[model samples]
Target: MRVYSKTLKEFLDAWPGKKRFGIYRFLPLFFLLGASLEFSMINWHVGEVNFYRTYKRRQARKIAEEILASREST
Candidate 1:
C-alpha cells in the first residue's frame, strides 16, 4: 500500500497541470470534508441526536427568557 501511494503521488506530481493548481491541491479540502462527515455520522450514530439544532434552540430560549426578565424589570 505504501508503494502504491508513493507511485500515486509521483503520478500526480507528473500529471499535466499547472504545478500550482493540480488535483493534489484539493486533497486537503477533500480530507477535511471527509473527516468532518465521518465524525458527524459517528456522532449521530452514537447519540441519535442533532446536537447543533438542540443547542441552538436551548440558547435561543435562554436568551428570550433573559430578555423577558429584563423587560419586566424595566
Candidate 2:
C-alpha cells in the first residue's frame, strides 16, 4: 500500500485559476459569501426572533448566573 500527502503549496497549486489569479482568487468568493451570510442574518428573521439577539441574551444570562454564583459562594 502507498500513502500520498500533499503540502499546502501542492494543494493550492492544484486548485483552478491558480495560474492567473494565485491565492487572491478565493478572496472575493469568500468575501461575498460572508457578506451574504451577514445580510441574511440581519434581514432574515424567523417570526419575532433573531439569531444574534438570542445569542446575546443567552450569553448575558450565563454571565449573570456566574456572577451570582460567585457572590453566593463568598
Candidate 3:
C-alpha cells in the first residue's frame, strides 16, 4: 500500500505544468469550466427545450406519480 501511494504521488507530481505552476493553478481553470457549464445550462436550448426546465418537469412528474401511487395503495 505504501509503495502504491508513493508511485501515485510521483505520477501526480510529474503532471505537465505542475512544476511551473503548483496544483492550485488548476483551480481557476476548473472554476471557469464550471461557470461556463452553468452559463450554457441556463442560456443554451434546443428549439425551446432547456436542461433545467426538463429536469424540473421530470422531477415534478415523479413526485406526482409517487403521490398518486401512495394514495391508490392506501
Candidate 4:
C-alpha cells in the first residue's frame, strides 16, 4: 500500500474472483521487526524534581493569580 498509489480500499475494489478475504502488508516494517522500538527510545521520567516540573508549576501559579486578580477587579 505504501509503495503503490492505490489505497487498500481501492485495491480491494479491484480484486479478481469472488473472495471476501485479502492479504495486505500494511505495516511491513513493524511486522518484520516484531518490536515497538519507536516507543522505547524515550525516557519517561527524568528525576523526581526536574526543571520541567518546576517551570510548569510556576506558570500555573502565575496564571491562577492573574485569574483571581481579574475576578476581584470585575
Candidate 5:
C-alpha cells in the first residue's frame, strides 16, 4: 500500500500520530486543488494555428538582429 512506501512511511513514522493523521486528512484536498489549477492553465487549440509559437519566433528574430547589430558596432 502507499502508506508503506519507503519515504512516506518513514516520514509518517517520524512524526507524532496526530500530526501524521492531520496531513493525511488534507492530502485529498491538495490533490483536488492541484488538478483544478492544471486544468485551468492548460492551453487549448483545437483547430486554430498556434499564435504563441509564431510570436516567440518573431521575438527571437528581433533579439538576434539586435545582437548582430551590437557586435558590428563594437
Candidate 6:
C-alpha cells in the first residue's frame, strides 16, 4: 500500500486552502469517479454494446416485425 499512501499524501498536499472538504463531499466524488470509470471501460465493448451509436439499430428491427405482423392479418 506504499503507492496508495504516497498518492494520498500527494493529494492532501495539493489542496489549495486551509479549509478542507468534509468526508461527505469527498466520498461522493470518489464514488462517482469510480462508477464513471467503470461505465467508460464498458464503452470499449464497441460492436457488442454499440458504444458510439446515437440511435439503437434494434428500434428499426422491432418496427419491421410489427409491420409484418399487421400485413399478415389482411
Please report the candidate that would top TM-score against the real structure: 3
Per-residue C-alpha lDDT of model 4 across residues 1-74, encoded as one tens digit per residue = 35455576676567553253345433454475655543332323466655556678999999999999999999
Report the error of model 6 at residue 20, Å.
Answer: 18
Each candidate's lDDT (Cα)?
A: 0.74, 0.83, 0.86, 0.61, 0.72, 0.67
In model 2, the runs with Cα more than 4 Å from the true position are 1-17
lDDT of 6 at 24: 45
Model 6 lDDT tens row, 47-67: 666443434556777889999
lDDT score, candidate 4, position 30:
49
**The CA-based lDDT of model 3 is what?**
0.86
Clash count (model 2, backbone only): 0
TM-score of 5: 0.36
Against the hidden reference, what TM-scores do the models get? Answer: 0.39, 0.67, 0.69, 0.37, 0.36, 0.34
Ranking by TM-score: 3, 2, 1, 4, 5, 6
- Of 1 and 2, the candidate ahead on TM-score is 2
Q: Which stretches of candidate 3 lie over 4 Å from their true place?
A: 1-21
Residue 10 CA displacement from its true place in model 4, Å? 65
Cα error, residue 60 of model 6, in Å, equals 1.4
Give the C-alpha lDDT of model 4.
0.61
Pairing residues by index, what is the TM-score of model 4? 0.37
Worst 10 residues of 4 by lDDT: 36-45
Q: Candidate 6 — which pairs collide?
A: none
Which scores greater on lDDT, model 1 or model 3? 3
> Residue 42 error for model 3, in Å?
0.8
* lDDT, model 2, position 40: 88
